[model samples]
Target: MKKYALLILFVFPISRTAWAQSPEVLAIRKYGTQNADKMMREFAAFLAIPNIARDTVNIKKNAAFIMSMMTERGIKNVQLLAPSTAGAPPAVYGEVKVPGATQTLIFYAHYDGQPVNPAQWAPGLEPFKPQLYTGTIDKSGKNIPFPTDGQYNPDWRIYARSASDDKAGVFTILSAYEALTKNGLVPTSNLKFFFEGEEEAGSPHLNQILEKHSALLQSDLWIICDGPVHQTGRKQIVFGVRGDAHMDLTVYGPKRPLHSGHYGNWAPNPALLLAKLLASMKDDEGRVTIKGFYDDVTPLTASEKKAMQEVPSVEAQMKRELGLSTVETTGAVLNEAISVPSLNINGMQSGNVGKMASNQIPTFATAVLDLRLVLGNDWQRQQQKVVDHIKAQGYHVIDHEPTDDERAQYGKLIKVIPGEDGYNAQRTPMDLPIAQRVIKAVQTTTTDPLVLQPTSGGSLPLYLFKKYLNANTMTVPIANHDNNQHAENENIRLGNLFDGLETMTAVMRMK
Candidate 1:
């Protein structure tokens, strides 16, 4: 585990009121402003801890820290729910039960973040050492020294691993509880906190945890605090998330590297074969060419289609910001495209490039593929579709590497290795009574209407909650659109963090 610097102290006076704030919003605002310095210091301290799921030792430290945070805030029954497997990161669970409350809502977020490469970060920036910046890195934002006073610029951002992808979620949820209690306000619904420890690793063991503790995890609905807000800067409430799976496909050439000059024309280059195989998966129009790829996709409901039309269009601005003049014609716009499944090549490796270029042919080439599944599509069946397509290409597919006699017998040999077992897609009806209450609660804090998405392009293990607890789950994300989640330089805008506290407070007081 890596060591981090001690928390910094800021000195600033608290303001009593904010402009155009309602009475309910004012209570949260006053509490947030008065404790801005304390909250940020604690947040930075949490961010400083290393939280890679595979690092069992450091992961436990994160879980322990969260337990302490909950216990000190007067939350009851705070405990860690571990899986049957030893050394697995446990999910931190705690609840605030209101007297005579009929409805229960479980608030969810993940503590684990994607692994990072320190070299990829900008100068003077470290993944675990949280730092404040005047703005986003893409805008050439400069680093700002931690203020000695509590005063912070709302435009400033806190950069760290999991800053936006999720630690922000954990901080906002717990802090909202603290603010409401200290301000003499009580929640109308029984609230439960479920912080996952291994979401970035694809949540392979989540089902184990859920099955082992289904009785304690029951709730009317789960309000997820993850992902990002809409591109237009309005809050977003996503009803579903895409299911995910990964595949590693390798095609063989000669057993050993050979001289390009001698075997150039005589030998079939594995790199070229792999390239052709990948190209065959997609067409010039960017639509998948795999047979039955779209057969299992569920169509959108009438209300879902209406919501899609109501979403503000940001494709023109997005294309310009992404520096792309053309996009795949699979869907008319970005939202429409995510409604269907997708096949993407995450990465490919064959031989050396740049200064490492060689005049020899590599032994083999490999490509890692990602498949995104929508409702009605099964993960196993989706993977088999790709495998069946490979078989149709006249290649012998095997799970393991081929032996001498087997290699000699088969002219074209390839290997397909599937990742951990994946789950299928899940969606809750957008018009449920609980869903309406969530939308109404969040609307009280924002002037513009919220963007309700049928499914976000990202994937989560939300289906497990539905399977084990039989509860509906909805995502109310608060990170800025360009927070750079799952990448280096990830951050959360200070304004979003403040607004998120208010948003959660509103949800807690919902009728």
Candidate 2:
């Protein structure tokens, strides 16, 4: 019996060695490294196109570019779902079906990005010109831009629009697929790719598209290639993503701008009114004051608590990177802070926001509020609560959609235009057999301890695939945590990008 046990232990690593010794996998790792420059150049071309949301013209061009790449790579059945008023920029869809495969995997990613304020870009760094950069800029302190000419440095990375948030992720996924199929490393499961064009704009028509193409979108599992890896550079296999929602509210007073000196004491100040109204939503301690806001927040289960405890101390890391003295909320760290719901004022505008300060009271003030919802919270209902709360505060609410007569008379009245619809949070069970296979495969690829985040602070439309298709969805982000996803100076580390390709290759080949 002792000899039997010894033999079993000896065979374990030998068995793994047999599987890991594939020439295809080794060539993929080698090619990913060797072709790093070529890959960056291709990415630079993709980044050169201004693929911001709402720009249907450029959106289609970008989609066409993706389709063209897939076709050039010999991918079969590539097609573009043309844009319409219902949805902007057609979604890029394609598939590779391997005969005798028992399972199918659907890969999801976004091809669109947030609008960039060109003036915010650094000198010699236009949003369309993808140059490499390093060093950090403190927006509050100083906006200094460091330059790097596409070389790997411990402190520097490639800087460009969509470099990290998602474009890098898409590149990684495609490269992995290319490396596999190119070298005859066929995936064990049938693979399908779905690249959407409206994720940055809240995925308003995604549900409709999903419903329309239920047969084509069906899969055993859906893998979202978005977001960023752990700050420590550990490979992560996330089980879920937190849901999100945004609401724009405004306070109006006199029909037009008023002279501050003339009505200093008597006239109502919309700006001041907006500030006071915003202050009412959250307390001094950062707790939200909305009625029943916390009542429906799903409680963290024992498993989720275990996962949270396993997450590295994000507080110290955040403070060190963000140059913050301390974190907010009751917890001492940022990850803990994310365990609850949050209300943030994303943007506010009323009067002049330029160098010249006009001494006139603005007639209207608008505030864009974003609410990050946790599990067990419904997005639509929660959005309604925000509207109710504003009304409860005794101010007349002006939603974006006005009555026809009101639109004709007011001729562009001060109103709220809902920026983006909210996404519902979702979490998948970690104990599932397929999930276990993925976790084990990731462990085989890297020595870093796997960080299993129960849910991320960022938003993704995971609920749709989970609820509509009954598919198990997971996120595998390739970008570094400090990639500055939505802000200026966005970038992705070449090392991280390479590692992502290796990990993705391993995931695809996992049986």
Candidate 3:
């Protein structure tokens, strides 16, 4: 039989109370142990498929695979939920109903993953090929062979795209129901599973899909299974998620590239100009300096503030692990910082570097800006603020590239292109009765205190669920914090994957 690590040994000891988990919970673990060999093979094969939202062919394959799993595990009415737009990636839907259960929960997780750059991944890993490692690759961990016996080390990790970011969520939710039924533990609440295929693309079609299927998707709650657990390895229940928007800004220089030595210091460099403009958007303390950036923020409620107070401080530990002696916010902690809006430059480009080095001055500088919005912050309004700030800084902001006449007329010219798919932030009340039940359901799986967060720093289109379906949502994330989400060499720890089985099982059986 396989031995599973219930909790990290160094993080928190198992409480006498947690160790006395009910018989149903114990049965769930046993099922995972006794079936690790067969389950691991199925999961590994699923991870081998490429699931980019724009790759229609491969994305459809993923949906078909999920439907097969649902059917084999006893889900009813499994189908692809399509939007009005043709060829858009669809959501896979299925459900399990109980005889007299009045309450229903729609479990949500995205099956799609962000696009990957193969060269950026570490030498030992590839985005599509799933590989096992003894520990984190960054910690001098070595690759290991998959065991043939029904045994796995909780410390081992599986590296692949979507392994943690959400496929783990889809796998866990489906397997949780399997555990319950195979062992004779019936769920108390009706269960539904929704696997979205376009979430990483900002969920551009989600609103339409929800509007088209309002009646079919009705539920008392939407338990989101994305993001990561607490950095301390404790489970977390998030009440809200930040909204997301992107801006593409370009600064114009010369009409053509100029030799640096021939016109050195004579011609203005757009790269320098762009850097200065970005630097002015924030202070040394990291607060966005744009006027009215914080003016629209909503203060936390008394209950929210009290819940925040109880959250364990992870700043010091985070800094030590991240190798930083200073944080951008002077006095605010991590939880307090995420409560407000933020601006970040995801990437910048001006001229070639390294082996592509050249002595010519580039004709333009471009940057991709990411804006994270908290409650009361509209994605459109937040983007406009940045545009307005640029105008106030003596530059002429245009939606199109500057013409020769306009370029000569204005000393500073920039083209500001805004994203069309941006959405605002959403938060469900922490005091809601359903929220309390979600908290308790996840708590039965661990001895450590469950982290109750007001809002996660990550951005999801969860607000659309509220806007289109008139329903509230909460989050129960299962990935390890260092899962390298949306980046290269992404992976999920074996223990987090196993623990998630019990957590979702408890939620499915919640009263």
Output the number of the lDDT-best candidate.
3
Consecutive 10-residue window with the lowest summed lDDT within model 2: 10-19
Q: What tens digits encode model 1's per-residue C-alpha lDDT throughout 391-492?
A: 998889999988988789888889999877577777889999889999999888776678999999899988988888888999999888888899899999
Which residue pairs show collisions in model 3? Answer: none
Cα-based RMSD of the predictions, in order? Answer: 4.7, 7.7, 2.2
Which parts of model 2 have CA positions greater than 4 angstroms off? Answer: 1-26, 82-87, 134-156, 400-420
Which residues of candidate 3, in runs, are more than 4 Å off? Answer: 1-20
Structural RMSD, model 1: 4.7
TM-scores of the candidates in the order shown: 0.95, 0.87, 0.96
Instruction: Using lDDT as the measure, name the better of candidate 2 and candidate 3.
Output: 3
Which 10 successive residues of model 3 have the least lDDT summed? 7-16
RMSD (CA, Å), candidate 2 to true, equals 7.7
Question: How much does candidate 3 score in TM-score?
Answer: 0.96
Q: Considering only N, C-alpha and C atoms within 3 Å, which residue pairs clash in candidate 1?
A: 10-148, 11-148, 11-149, 11-150, 12-150
